[model samples]
Target chain A: MTATTLETDLAGLVAQASEGAVTPAQALAEPHSLGLLGLTSLGFLRLIHAVERRYGVALDLDDDVSYLDTIGSLAAHLRERGV
Target chain B: MPTVAVRGAPGAAAPLTWGQYAIWAAIGRTAPNDHYFNLTRVLTPPDRCRPLDPDTALDRIGTALSRHPALRTRIVPAGTAPGRAPAGTDRSAVPPGSAVQQEIVAEADVAVRTVAAADEATAGSAATDLVEELAATAFDYGTEAPVRVGLVLVDGAVARVVLALCHLATDGHGADILLRDLRLALLGRTGPPPGDPGTVVAEETSAAGRDRSDGVVDTWRDAYRALPPSMFPTPRAEPQPVRWWVGRLTSPALGLAAAALAARHRTSVSSVLLAATAAMVSADGAGDRAAVLTIVGNRFDPSRRDLVATLSQEGLFTLDTSAADFADLLRPAWRESLRAYRSGYYDQLALDAALAQVSAERGEQVHPMCCFNDMRLVDLPPGPAPTAEQVRAARAATVFTWAAPQPLVGCRFCAHVTAAGPALTYQVTGDTRYLPPQRLRAFALGLEELVVAAVAGPAPLAALPARLGGAAA
Candidate 1:
């Protein structure tokens, strides 16, 4: 997938995970951080599940979680993992 | 104790669900004191509702049992049929073996003990004693239903209802749901039908279930590898005669400060409290990174929201407490807490296998053992941040007391947070060898002081040991 398409797909998952609390546009905009963008603890778990389901790659937060700082960083990490 | 016969819609026999298996394993580990897992609740009808007579109370209890199949469910050895426990064989003596199955009975008798009191105060006292008696009694999983009911009659009217529920039947959240349904039943109303336990069993054993369980085990393996073998590896003091001690701290200031911090950090109150606990554990010289097994209520799924079953499980939460300011830990704590909660739902057997594998690899057991449970059903929302003076004044009402020591406990450090009226109560039950009675008091009080101090400004992590009076150091 192209960069834009990948981000758009991720944004859709983020929106769904947030239970519509954070819009797809807001997610794509790359706000301060997911936590600041109003993604709840349960929403974050749902996002992890959604990402794992979509990418077939489990997200390990115990590892270096700097990727979780923002959407752009998360997208970059996924790309490095051959997403 | 008078027996009340209750008949409900019977459910088919099925293998225990993943959640049930987890609690069942704990029950076995706990053994004779398996009653430790009993959840007790004393409920009274609201003033708006009419007083209940003995017959009406019995009818309500029956309605509740019929609505929630879990209340009438009984567990037996894997292959044994519901009512056909091999004739004359002692069902209670049956070992859990590798698996146990649960069967819902159409007719089961519940022990209903009644206490008559002259007034509400007398009734309350009688209810408390009855609740303690019922709660301390272990449930015979094979032969008895999962619930014991007690009614306290004030002037011949049922004024209070006490229920001692087996943890195998329901968790804290599930218990709340049961209480709500029971209240509705008392008012001659019916709530939505609860989720079927058999469906839970089927879903848990399906292909999707296996995959989910596998994923959770994989997560556990990775976490076990990353975390220290044990949070309390070295004993700081000799074990007391009792071996385990419990300390409880009730602080209105801690509640106020925690709410303020949670609001400021834009996270849940649980995360704020967890961050402080990680800080304290780290200060106690455990390590720069603190790992705690946080109890997770696995009720995120909409379908399982109202399911009166044991779905709560522990999730591993590892946090780096090497930050300069305590506030810096809240965001990461929240994030890792979410991860832990996600990892809580899995096959307990598979999780054990994974732990064994990791322990073998590491040449030691890989269990954090330290636990944190926030038992509040709904967190107190962040109100206006309390001023430092306000928090300090509220601190005068803080109470720290040592509870009865236990001969056996499940963990070295088991911390729980619950709302107590206008205060937040923190209870820590620790192995006496690791946390002496004095240190236990310090730990509980330290939690309150740390949170209350943070309300004024950013609390320095380096100053934590001194603030805790070097109890952690």
Candidate 2:
């Protein structure tokens, strides 16, 4: 997927993961820990569900959590995985 | 123990939010458990550069009381208790709500106990005892302050500081904030502490404009009436003392196993854990379908993420382990968990009405007695991370320990799971009468075994070794 499309989809998932505690623009802000923003494991799991459904790719459950710590990194991880 | 001094005047009274109202109701409905009142303890060891002195500690507490409105808040009798709802009433049920109202005292006073311990050991023991006493004793919120301060001194040096609060005043998040602010206050920081997030949330939630449907009162009502209660063994007529038994699996291997299961099942570790818990519960004869109440942090909204308030609420889930395969349960378990988290923020009065409806229909009072809390995000202090081999050996050793005694009010079961690096600690508390020490140990070990087995492979629930479920025993 193109970087632009990936960012949009990943941002949406982060927003959903936060349960609207943070907007997509706010979550995409660099260097903020999603944990502090209220992205709980449940949230991350839900984000996984959304990513799989939208991109039709599976996430390794053991994927390094640092990649999921921010919207930017998660988007990059997905791109690397050819999502 | 003699009270050294009582420090402020009665402040203005405010209405209790639905969240506070629910806690007040639970306190009134259930048998008294002092553990519920113990909010947080801020301990300062001697190693800290600036240890707290008795005078400075009291000063900091005084500052917190004056700065935060909730810290000074207490529950006073409002009008005559709302009349009790008639049987068979659902949403139509009315309240014999407690005759209590939240009033923020303009001035909050704390009851202080100054202990002059003979030595460091004495100081440590005294501090521990004082905290237990403070947490267990029921506070007369209408007359007494919701917060209590205990200062322990060794050789005239501040050895430890304990601050215990009532649930009515602050939730876990708020307690942590109070602790941080107290530390700042010790450093001589001052001002009206951060704005009262509790007030903001209450105002917004209680607003007439907010949507009530999101609370999903009906979903909870249906679950309460339909799901089977978690039947441990026997229903004791009298409340029994409570005890805590903890088991830890501090292995990176367990994490790896959980991740593999989650990946294979296309779910999260939490879902895997929940499904494993259900299998353990069913094998222990708590029935094949265990209805559990999950504690939702309720910090999903960014606005309230840093707000110091009692936003945590209980979401009810009925996990059916009737499926022989543990893997089969993850999908359904995940769905139920999500639904529970979404509906965790229902109106207290509506929940009460639902409880009344279920009670009348069942010809007995029914309550969700089992609680499962995932405290991974609660930000507990981290401990040393064990090596993979150490984690494996620790799991194999399987040692168990009882936490210090706390007052047990009734027959309530709760499991709080905390993770530090690769180590997982499952602290399980239950009324000893219902779940004797042996039974509780078995239950805890059974849970750990399920995780170990799941990590080994995609084992179905019933296909796992009987020893894991304690069934072989």
Candidate 3:
């Protein structure tokens, strides 16, 4: 899949896993707010694993995901790698 | 033979050992966002009328080990098999490596073996000795080492077993399944074929892989990496391995009640547990100040099956019980817990390394010597019982992992409760030098009392230790 497609899929996954019962897309978009997305330090981890599987590439979570919280950040992340 | 499945999401960076980093980096030939920490132990009946046969035990452990492929961790590469690194987009790709993929024993060089001890006390002592020796292979970082076998002598007859695994390969629930298989194996029951569930996996992991922006943890690594030389000081002596101490507390029904309380409190069982621990830390560390670290398990994903890697991060919650109006601390704690997940910034291992480096540069203690862990939620996936290993009346048995790590703290609080289990189990490990066993019990009871009290009605604070003192002893 193109990096862009992969990014969109990941956005959907993160939004779906929103812990606070918020809309998946919103959770993907504004994960920084409290109560909007009940994502925990633990939830971030599970998402990484899921995305890695869907994309089929080794993701340096330390290098990438740690900085990408919102979908915009994630898209920017993909853009940086020429995704 | 036993079958183990890990169900959790992996994060950006969890508190991983160097051993873990090296292994993943070596295999993928690039960094991958997958790591797991697991604890496994084997127990025998309380007494032994029969001296457990080593061959039988080895067979049991081996059969149990056979079910899990160390190489079960497959990475779908970004492109063709072993082609050029897929540009930056598919920067890395791979087929399972010999070390990490296609095997249950991640590294046979360091995996564990069973040794029959002379007796119970000997077995107990031997377990540590073996751990210490085996630990020498990878001292600092906890890896996905194979099933480490230790003996638990029950009545000088049947040798109970202990399987101390690196967190990468197993978890509390998986460990329970392994133990059940071992117990059945002891009675001569064989499990399903090796790799039967995730059996038909594509042997050659496709190189065409995914983007790497999934974030559950935010390590302050880059910020630290960018820090001036002055912020990263040189270490004098390597961290001296101090005598590790451990303690235990049984929160029978207490933990579940706390979970219910958490539901009322509008948080998770883990969050409430952390809040109570925050109170305990604030109370204990003199000046009502403390730094607390909690494990955040990311097993929410349903697609990827290998949940065993060190796929977690640390959630840092600083409780300044010193804050005026102790009750108000709840709002901030709740907010922090809620935001921690949302912020996706608290990377477990990277941030820890960064903080440690920064602390050392400033010459402060690198770690918050004591920590609290509340593994109260279980991620056991329901499976149709294979008609193969049907043994009834066999209550699902589980090994207390936090129990084994107790010896390492001045005071450690471990609280875990399974949905199916009846009790809220806590293991408190400590030494006399830090505090007497009784006093540790007091601290645990005090914490439980505190949690229960808060759950009851946020009433006047009561002395937890004094209330539950006699029961722990």
Candidate 4:
């Protein structure tokens, strides 16, 4: 997936997780923890599952939180994984 | 003043459900601090823009007590013949036919302790201290009321109300119902009538036959035998006296992620979190096989859904974390959660006897190392959907979380997860000696990361630095 597509999908998941507290445009415009945007632990897990299913990439990154801090970084990481 | 005793409400007397009996049994066997109890705190500015007077406060509490039968009920030990003394304090003193009973009081004197504090914070702290003190003191199920209330005054105005209940009287959900109704009564509104316990008891009694079938008990027995002895890493020794180190993990991301996964899997968000917990514990090398005691809110019976009573029970769920891939385990985790819920409401005494039998056969005690309670479903009324201005205001407001010092019980570790708005808050308490503070905090962080990775993709799960059986890290 292209960076744009990855960002779009990540934004949708973030918005869904946040219950529309943060929008797709807002999520892509900045770098912050999705946690700050109201994405719950369960919601984040679901987002991971959604991203994996969409790109067919399995994220084995346990015990790590740096990549999940922001949408930009998450997209960058997914790009590195060739999602 | 001394507490005033009263009789139960007419027509509300009934047998204790299996769940209550299990907790009652545990309380009877354990130390003074071992009982399963809940403390709730509500802070309000004032009533109708004026200070809440003592009489008004009593009136509100009295109205609430009158509405909820569970709040006014006392435990009557089984099979002592009506109006006779309950079979003694010891478990063995009670005979086989002696089931726990609930006798609701038609009217009773409410114990309202008035504490004077300088401010809201001090008031809340005082109330919390009282809750801790009350929790350590065992309840006299044979005579005294199972519920108590504390009112804190700030600058001569009622500001904080704390309601503490023994798990025998009500579960968290029931407590919430009581509080909601109490709030309404305080506002001078008549809340809904007490939920029909008579109908609930009848339905449960009817279903008791199917619940006793051999197939159900045998399935649970097999599951218990298959479970790992303990799925948590503790210093190798007999379990020590319970001590608690509580911490909170707040994240909005986790709530949404779990919701999405739950939707995709067609399961509840709780199942998703539990699966994640099992995976996290296993990945940390707590155990290759995860055996957890999950608290199931047995409100699935529609008739009892709104009743204020103890409808929560602990159900065992075991999982194999040996899978190299985390995604491969979600389906099985969800399935096992269903099985656990289905077999949740069996007789506590019979189940304990069966567990002892299984433990003997296995040549070791088989108890879950961890306990998980999901309180997300017991939500308060939601605030109106946020407008842009409201969202900005919320963002601008300083965010702070204050957690009361809580005591731990039953097991070495217990994790209670609740939702605050879109964010998820985890209240974890455990014995720090067994689970060192640093390591426990690390495990909590790992749980968060594990969920991130579980959905991140099919990457190999990371192994913790040190296994429990290996040398101390």
Query: Candidate 3, residue B36: CA error in Å?
Result: 17
Model-by-model DockQ, in order: 0.21, 0.11, 0.08, 0.03
Q: Which regions in candidate 3 have their CA more than 4 angstroms from the true location?
A: A1-83, B1-38, B42-64, B71-145, B148-168, B173-245, B286-289, B304-306, B320-331, B338-353, B360-363, B377-421, B431-439, B460-473
lDDT of candidate 3 over B1-473, digit per residue (tens): 22233222222211122223333442233112121123535466333324665555555556555555432222233232332223324222333222222222222322334455676666666666654444333211222334455544444444556666544344453455566666766666765432222222221111221011113322333333332322112222233243323445554444544544443443445556666666654444323444454544434454323323443444445544555433445555654554444322232234445567776776645444344455643321112211212211121332233233221322233333334464555555444343344545566667666665554345332332244332211
Off by over 4 Å in 1: A1-83, B81-83, B87-92, B96-98, B380-382, B387-389, B466-473
* Model 1 steric clash pairs: none
Per-candidate RMSD, Å: 4.4, 8.1, 14.1, 10.9
Best by TM-score: 1
Best by lDDT: 1
Candidates arranged by DockQ, highest first: 1, 2, 3, 4
Write model 1 residue lDDT over B1-473, tens digit each, in one string.
67767677787778777778888887777676677778998888766565777887787778776678788787766787656654334545455433677788787788798888889878788888899989887787877888999999887888998999989889999999999888888888888868876777777789999998898889788878988788766677889998889889988888878876766666667878888888888877778889998888887665777799888888888898989988888878877887778878898888988899999999988777799999985553423555678788898999988887777777889998889986888999999898778877887787787788887887888887775556454
Tens-digit per-residue lDDT, B70-184, candidate 2: 7666555574232221223331122213666665545544667767778876776788888877777666555566788888888776777787887877777667767777666
Candidate lDDT values, in order = 0.79, 0.61, 0.42, 0.63
Top of the candidates by DockQ: 1
Each model's TM-score?
A: 0.86, 0.74, 0.49, 0.71
Prediction-by-prediction clash tally = 0, 13, 77, 35
